[model samples]
Target: MDAGILFWKAFCENGESELIDLTTIEASMTDSVVATLPVINPSTYTKTISSPVVVIKSEYRRYHHALKASNEAMPINLLYGWGLIGYWGGVMFLGTLWKVGQWFYYLRFNKSKAKDIEKPNQSSQGELALPKSLAMLRHWILLYIVIPATIGTYHQRLFWWSNIPNRLDSLIVFGFWALSIILGFAGYDTFSGNPTVTSLPEQNWEMLSDRTAILSYACLCWLWMFSGRNNIFLWATGFSFQSFNIFHRHIARICTIYAIVHSIGYTVEWIVYYPKYFKSLKENWFIFGIVATIALSIMLGFSSVFLRQRSYEVFLVIHIVLALVVIVALFIHTSYFGTQYNGYLWPTVAIWCFDRFLRLVRLVYCNFSVFSGKAKTTNASVMYSSASDVIRIDLQPTASSLKGRPGQFYYLYQPYTLRGWENHPFTLGAFTNGFEDSSPNTPEIVKKKVTTTTTAQLSDSSDDAVKLKSYRSSSLSNTLTFWIRPYDGWTKRLRNECIKGGGVCYPKILIEGPYGHTQMLHTYDSITMIMGGTGIACAVPYVQDFLGKSKIAISYTSKIKLVWTVRQPEFVEEVCANDLSAAICDQRIEFEFYCSKKNVPTNISTSVHSSDEVTKQIIIQSGRAPVASLIAESGTEAKLSNSRAAVLVCGPAAMADEARAAVHQALKNGCRTLDYFEEAYGW
Candidate 1:
């Protein structure tokens, strides 16, 4: 008998259902197969039993090493996953500390009486020195030096890469990629004498394929974590959705790279070593993995900045569909492993479900009321301004608990339209408390008549009466306003509808959020806002909040300078006449308007009359706004006054970049206690 068959016979004869002692079986099989086999069948088994024994041992050792390699690879894969979690946890911890410090700072200011408040300069030298120096160091190191700076000659690309993140973000991404590469190749053991894999190169390829596949699975968890609009990371860290968005794109790239490598490694290994390559291509696991990899590549291609900028709605649809395909394909691709690896995948589904649940909660809370008995929904009064090419929407939600704050935004849905499921994010321009019933039954003529009568009353009334009227309207209104620049798609459609309805229409609108972190601008002593066009939506709320807090005697901001740049002087007039009427004549606020139109005169002055019967003269300068000089002047004034200043910029890419560069130079030039905030419009 052959040595291999004889060894099996001895193991079976010992006990088929019980565990055989390898030492006893090997001792019996070696003597029986080696000493007795040659005498019984000398023609076939003439060679010594040493050769068959060695072959059996070599096969057993190869199987042992394969199992050991798989066992060792698992914990390393888990460690890579845990490493990602640890990195984000550290970031959130720092953010939590900053949040707690901010809370205490605000608490101290809130408790102090207005009369007892000390001026910035009156604070003791010792108390100010440490904080001021720390502020300078933080701005110099993190904001100016690390965060905004880019790699190499990518200064101009900053404008193009506005959709991407800055230098610090790149460094973090590179670090993650480097770590993954190291883990993918490291700790893999390959032996030349293995029976399963004849060559060292073949074993190496098989191990590489296995490691990359598992690491890719590990990365999928984070990919989904960063893709949500309702990310806990955002809540914990107080970072913007934009910041996590950059993280999402980079992670997707990394995961896709791993998947590609995994697929290629297996392909090469099968073609070179295994003749069953063509047959394996028909297997369910192989087919689904190829589908997943292709789906991911498609998603990456369509999610480019150029493609997104061209048509966001289309990109959004493609992204959603392909995301589902990739998830499902990946789930099926790894299902052959049963539940061993599915732990990483199910969390992605759970996260997505949780995000959707919160979105539904927000939507229901913001748009519907239990007491209204399902009949009432959020309503919006939309009006189009031809002079400014802007749409003004005053949305009145049924739920009063939904409040607005500076830097918060909402996703608006026009449910009556054909594409009612489509929603767009707009900054919450302003919100007030009493309802204005512009129901569909209300006539446009009646609305015009009421507006004319109010204007007449305001013109004839005394300053106190006008102020009282302004105060009453503002205090008693229950509406949230969103200023929409009439771009393409939904905004353009809204404009057309408003125009068709004689410059105004009442549409059924649904609001889904009050998302985004509120800027703590009131903590600063001086605020300089540089707004361009519809960017004023970001500035108006902060101004209103400051004025409102001051009215309650809790405001920390002493002075606010608003520098607005618009293409049309008419747009400036329109906004100042309405949304900004409260701050127009306020003594603490200063306004500068720049009209960047060829037809507009360089030295034109416009008088904006507030409801308080106060006339504020706003000079509109022609040509582009001197953004750098404005920022420099604000920093210089704040430094001279020994006050903490904040520079807020929200505008076109060119203007924002200019402001960023200006702030960087100011910090570099020893402008202490100055902080910069940017509200980018990129989605």
Candidate 2:
């Protein structure tokens, strides 16, 4: 009989009661058919199967190879998932460790120095040698590696590739790109003979598509993780929101790249392999995938640094809307995979929701209070100074726990305006006790008399000065102030409102945060500040903090120097008359004002000499401030005193860069005890 009949006869005898290993039976039949055939007895099953068995064997082997290939790919997909988690977790771990180290150093060394008298030998001690050495190393890394462009200066100094920012950032992004490419093509065990339109094998296209799709989902989690204002990483690491924002933008680009690759791979596969390519595109999963890719592309295109710098509000709205669209579309696209890939998608939604929830909690806690069945709200008084061309806002929040500190900032919202939801971040310039408002019409003679009497009393007796300080310290009302330089958009409108109300206005303001980490400048022996224009806002609070600490006799900062450069002499005079009045005459502090404009008023020139001995220490000049020389002089002073120093710069881009370069050069020239801090909003 034929081999087909023989196999049928064997199947009837087996009666489906015994399930045979067709794969193993088929393999053995290729070598020796009679020995491997399933039979109750050898005498009853004498017929041999031939070509028919070979045909059936080839069919089973095909599917067996496919299943084997799928099993091999599963672990790689899972590895990509865990790799993302590990990278992010490592960053958080490092941040937490750094924070703990900072706290330990403060408690162990600086705290005791603040409370006790320093021994003469303490100044020459090498106790802080390790930390200073580490600081120098970190500066070297930043100057040579992190801050430079990848290939050339054009990208770093020009607006064309501002998105990447620097070499280190680009390298990090390139690492992810390399990872996706490597994993997409490696470890494939099976391939079909058919070739794709791109000339890649059909199985190669399938694996590449699947891998990129899964990797993109993994990256989505971190993209959302870094976008939050209240990211825990900020608190643990002391990194500014701007640093995380750079990470967010880069991760978004990597994610979009993955998505584009995934989309294109499948598109080519369908066009070449499937006859009904357009029909497949009509499917829900395919359409959602396309939607997600397009949304991501649009988000990346519109989120360029150039465009964001030009119109932030418009960019923000587009970013938010497209973000939602991408998330929803991704959810629908991956829904067909059931719960298999939901692990990556759900965490993304949870992270975004958690961030928004924290923001809501902060808003409620900072703005509203309930006492005896009534709610109280925070109000602000805004005044515009035409001389300085800046807005001064004073806010007193009812929330007792909301205390302002150095380096902290808040988002101010004008609830009564058309765009009430709009808000802007400003540094907390100063905070003081709330006092009863005095009449604006108080006579100049009365003011001069009171001021003269107070000055004489302060000058004549230490006891009287102490009593005045005590009286001021005892009144503890939380009044927070912010100085905003008026520009286009919200700030200009705010200026108009102040102008309309005769240079001052009281608007219902909502405070959203006290964000940012504070630097422990008090731990340093000396401090140098390089400020430009309205960057004085960054300097005033720290000066006041050092003075307050000195009053309590618990500060290590023995010397403070401020170098301010402004366009107008009037602004300098205004700041001196208001913000710098208290600290201006302090013996340990020095002030150097450089006005870029040439025409200095005679009255202003004479005002610096009005106090004679008290104001004689302040130097006023016309020209650009010598940023490098100032930094070098401060370093030299610190070196001579054998004390650690901090150099802080907050100013326009060029001024800040000049200061940074100066500090870096100082470090290279053996200024080991110097630490650098920069305060500027990257956005």
C-alpha root-mean-square deviation, candidate 1: 7.4
Best by TM-score: 1
The reply for model 2, stretches above 4 Å from the true place, is: 1-34, 37-67, 114-127, 131-200, 433-476, 598-619
TM-score of each: 0.84, 0.81
Local accuracy of candidate 1 as per-residue lDDT tens digits, 324-414: 9988998888888887878888999999999999989999988887785656678777877676667878887878766667898889888
Compared with the true structure, model 1 gives a TM-score of 0.84
Residue 154's lDDT in candidate 2: 28
- For candidate 1, give the lDDT: 0.71
Candidate 1 regions exceeding 4 Å error are: 1-70, 111-137, 143-147, 151-164, 191-196, 372-374, 434-477
Compute the lDDT for candidate 2.
Answer: 0.69
Q: What are the lDDT scores of the predictions, listed in order?
A: 0.71, 0.69
Model 2's C-alpha root-mean-square deviation from the true structure amounts to 8.6
Candidate 2 lDDT over residue span 396-422, tens digit each: 787877876778888888888899989
